[model samples]
Target: MLNAIEMILICLVAQAALTDLALRKIPNVLILSGLLLALILHLLSGQPGAPLSQWLAGGCAGFFLFLPLYLLRGMAAGDVKLMAMVGAFVGPWQAVQIAALSAQLGGAMALWMWWRYSSKVSVGIPYGVAIALGTVGVVAWRHH
Candidate 1:
């Protein structure tokens, strides 16, 4: 049962990573799909309406977790929402940790991208890839 969500999340994370790497953006459809999936799964599990606290925590974690990077122009707003969706399914604290790790990975990758393309184009790497990858790492670590 839980594996189902895990699979879905893993797949989506992979897609997000690819999109971020290729297009430099995490599409709205992908993030929306994740939220919809969690809602549908929550309903199917007979939990109809998940506790408001959980959703609130998830949203809060997702937003504030990425705020610093956003302020620093290190990431995008879309990535923040994406992480929130992940939090909506996983919870707050874990989501924060995942975001933190992902940000670290993203930061390192961004630096590399910057250096690699220093003379080509002035742009930042799509950090959604890092978030998705980081989330996967946290999930696997949590389960193990």
Candidate 2:
């Protein structure tokens, strides 16, 4: 059985993936709600160590890591927010891993799409799919 955190992460990633694929936009409501829920979960977990503190650190890590890409126009603000929400679930180090893995998946998908649809005028990538897959991959790897 999946725990609360895993279920929440899966839901967040799935919702983001669907909206991003369909509309090319990640909604603020989804991201903000995910963030709030993650913080609440962390606070409620009440582990020996400060889970909320770790979550905050993770959120910062995710925000800063993707901020550069957003500033450079390589990524969107919604994507950055989505990642920060993810970081709020995982810790800083795991968020870094998720980001790295997602980037690689996104890059590969872009390359494949470009190659396969060279004639298309626009081959925009749905990056949230990559993030979702990456999150799944990391979770599986960690739990294994």
Give the candidate number with the greatest lDDT. Answer: 2
Q: What's the number of clashes in each of the models? A: 0, 0
Model 2, 49-114: lDDT tens digits are 646566888889888888998999888888888889898889799899999999999999888988
True-vs-predicted CA distance for residue 18, candidate 2, Å: 0.8
* Model 1 vs. true fold: TM: 0.84
Per-prediction TM-score? 0.84, 0.93
lDDT string, candidate 1, 75-114, tens digits: 7878877887888777688888888798789889878987
Q: Please identify model 2 stretches exceeding 4 Å from their true place.
A: 48-51
Question: Which prediction has the highest TM-score against the true structure?
Answer: 2
